[model samples]
Target: MIELLGKNLTELQAIIVEAGFPKFRAKQIMDYIYKRYIFDFQAMQQLPGNMRDWLTTHCAISIPEIVTEKTAPDGLTKKLLLKLSDGNQVETVLMKQHYGNSVCVSSQVGCAMGCVFCASTTGGLYRNLDTHEIVAQVLLFGSLLKERIHSIVVMGAGEPLQNYTNTINALRLLHEKEAFDIGYRRMTLSTCGVVENIYLLADEGIPITLALSLHAPNDAIRREIMPIGAHYNLENVLAAVKTYYEKTDRRVTFEYILIDGINSSIENAHELGTLVKDFPNCNVNLIPVNGNEHIQLFKPSRRQMEAFKNIVASYGVAVTVRKEMGDAIQAACGQLKVQHAQKQSE
Candidate 1:
């Protein structure tokens, strides 16, 4: 069945016309669904009972059902297992921040990126999520919390850039004034350095922040953790990022995950600085590494992390260590989905 909730006003109008309803009814449906967040046709008071019944029979408004929920001790992070229509479950995380509640949405049932440390890519790629499924994740999470989300990160279970078109369409729906109306700037798209999509996203001209999962400063270390790193080597990835900056005029955020004795050295920091020194607008964000079970590396010692950051900064590269959030709940990126998949397979 076709999904109705993710369609924008213009697309909804086309669907309404095709469904033999007056085109004006599309705006009425939009008001009920987007403005009121009501999916029940009976709740659409403006629509006639007959029309509501017709809509119910012809269209489906899909929302993921909560299969499991784990809340952190601090009461700030909630990890949810969302069972999709196909009975496959994907994970979404609701994190409470000082600014407001932010949700991370998954873009695929499984991932193809195959970042060795990430469980989402472990069993191989399953299938890509449609635009509707992606948007539903945010709506379902927000509806349960009873608080409007102020920001969203497409950095959950799947590599969003791998499913480029649908990911972009979902982002568009998320920002629609009639729907979530989230500001484009508040939305971040995190990629594991998909060079082509970086250029594609820049060409779209949206000012949304772009995050590169640059776990290593150079190609050799990256290939050890992320197999795709071999195909898109550091040379090519850095050049693509340079082009992206030129086209978008936006500072790219390079995400560096610090693993003990791995890519956490002062030399690695110097290499990082050299790679990005020319791009004055970019910032390198240091993430104390998590997901040690999949990867047998410990989080860097505070001293080591600080030393690395200081060295990079000494080279005139702006660097900041990302504060850990929802650590008690295993809400550190990719942890929840990995746990859920293990349980299911057991």
Candidate 2:
């Protein structure tokens, strides 16, 4: 069946027009899907019975099924294990912040980046999610909440820059006026230092915040933790990041995971500070490394995290420690999926 979720009005219009239906039928279908959160064509009462029947057979709405859900004690976070049509599953998160709700969407079934501390890469790379699959994630949550998600973060299971085309297309589709109409500025795409793709995104004209997972200050520490650092040196990565900032004028965010005895030391903090101090409009976000059933990573003490942040801030760079959220439930990306996999194995 032809997937209908990611196509724009022109594409949808062509499909219906070729089938001897009026061009306006595309608009009607979009109204039901985006506005009413209707996926099954048969439930579109306004469309003619024959049209609906045709859509049901010839077209498919590839929305993921929420097989399991976990909610935190504070009721501000929800993590869902979504099963795709092909039986592959990916995780999506809904974080309820004081300003508004933000949905975190994955770009692939499993990650290939092989970040040592991440559970998302345990299963290895399966496949990149289609544009519709990525777009469907947000709609699924919006349907459940009975409202639109205020913002989107492409910082879930996969390296979004690795699946560059589909990731970008999904964001563009979500930004369509008839669709969510969420501004590009409200979106943030995080990648594990895909230098080439970072350059490509800078030219895409989308001003989404670009987040680089720079878990270490220098190439030596980074290569030990993330494989991408070995492939692309810190200098090259920062050059690409610089180009992205110059082109988009959107402030770049560097994600540094604070593993207790690793990258959170005072020396690492100074190196990190010196590296990005002159970069225009940038911030360093220090996240405590989350431990999981697969590994025994450790996070620095609260005082240590503050000390690291202060050292980085002293270099004239904006820095902030990410507040822990969804502790009652498994909040780390891929943690829930890994647990579910282990249970099935047993």
Candidate 3:
């Protein structure tokens, strides 16, 4: 069955016309799926019985099945392990902040970027998720909450830029006015310095925030933690980030995961600060590395984190330590999915 969840209006129109239905039927179907959030065609009482029957036979509004969900003790952060049609699973997160609700969506089943501290790549790469699968993650969360999701962060599980086409298409579908209508600025796509894709995104005209997983200050240190750094050097990555800023004028965010003794030193902070000092619009986000037994990484202490931030701030660069959330539930990306898979296998 054709999954209609990710198709744009033009694509839907083509499908309707090809199915021997009037062009207007596409709009009608979209009204039910996008506007009303109705997935079952039979529940769309406005359509004729024959039309509904034909739709039931030819099309499906695909949504991932929630295999498991865990809510943090805070009661505001929830993590979901969703199973796709083929049995592969990915994790999505719902975070309730004071301003609004933000959903974290995954772009691939498993990750290829083997960042030493990240649990996502422990199992290695599986496959990229289709556009429908990516969109379905947000829709599934929204359906459960029965409220509008304020924003999305494509920072879970995998490198979004690696699956560039599907990632961009999914964002477009989510931004469709008839559906979620999430503003471009409200969306953030994080990449592990995919330099070429960064240049491509700069030209795409979308104003979504581009976050780079820098992790370390120089190529020497970065290459030790993130393998992607070997191919795309720190200098080249910053150049691409500058190009993105010039093209879109969007402030880029550099995600620096502070592993205890690896990249959390004051010297590292000063080096990072100098690197980004000349950039027109950019900020550094310090994430205290999440602990993963399988990965053998330690989280930085509060004092260590604050000192590093102060050092960076001294260089006239904007910096903020990411607020820790959902710790009790293993809220970090890939933590829940890996644990779930292990339990299932046992």
Candidate 4:
């Protein structure tokens, strides 16, 4: 069945016209699906009964079902485990911040990156989600909030750049005026330094913020932690990001995960600063590692975290620690999904 949820107005027009319906019918379908939040074709009262009946047979408006939900004690953060049509589940996070509500979406069912600290790699890579599946995550989470999600972060579960086509298409659909109407600037995409895709995304002309997961100051330490580092070294990754900034004129954000005795040393912070200091207006966001059963790495102390940030700032680079959110409910990207799957098997 054709997925109507991911199609933009132009694609929907072609589908409708090819199916012996008027082109204008596509607009009405868009209104019902996006504006009215109606998913069933049979309930679209404005459409002719015969057209509705045809749509029901040929197309589908699918949304993932929530399998489990965990909310933090403060009520500011909620994590949802959504089960897709094929019974594959992915986790999405809703964080209500002082500015607005931001949602984090997963690009694949499971991850292949093998980032040692990330629980998403616990099950290996399952499958890349379809474009509609990716878009549905944002829409479903937005509906739960009962308000428009002001920003989106594709930093959950899988390596988004690995699922390049679908991830990119989902962002485009969400930015459409006929759909979510969210601005391009409100989106942030995180990658484990996929060099080829970094160059590719820069040419696509989307001005979304690019957050490179630079956990280590050099290639040697990165290889110790993330398997992907063996393939693309820090030198190449940093160069790709530099090119990306030049092309898009958007400041890149370097995401450094602070793990105790690993990448949290004062010297490591100075090396990090030297590596990124020459880049034009880049920001370094330090995230304290969240230890799980699978990864034995622990987060650095608050004093250590602050000291490291101060050293990085001395290089005339902007650096700050990322605020911890949704800690009580296991809000890290794949933590909830891993726990749910473990229970199902038991």
TM-score of model 2 vs. true structure: 0.98
- TM-score versus the correct structure, for each prediction: 0.95, 0.98, 0.97, 0.97
Query: Which residue runs of candidate 4 sit more than 4 Å off their true CA positions?
Result: none
Worst 10 residues of 2 by lDDT: 289-298
Write candidate 1's Cα lDDT for 235-345 as tens digits.
Answer: 888788878778777778999888888888889889988888877488999988775654676788999999999988887888999888777777765677778778879
Worst 10 residues of 4 by lDDT: 140-149
Off by over 4 Å in 1: 344-346
lDDT, residue 76, candidate 2: 95
lDDT of 3 at 280: 83
Candidate 1: global Cα-lDDT? 0.84
**Cα lDDT of model 2 by residue, 164-239, tens digit:** 9999999998998878889999999998889989999999999999999999999998999999888999899999
* Residue pairs with backbone overlap in model 3: none
RMSD of each: 1.6, 1.1, 1.1, 1.2
* Candidate 2 wrongly placed segments (more than 4 Å): none
lDDT of 2: 0.91
Model 3 TM-score? Answer: 0.97
lDDT of 4 by residue, 1-346 (tens): 9989999899999999999999999999988877777899999999999999999999999999999999999999999999899989999999998989999999998899899889999889999999998888888876676687889999989999999999999999999988888898999999999999999999998999999999999999999999999999888998999998898888899999999999999999999999989889799999999895457889999999999999999999999898889988888889998788789899
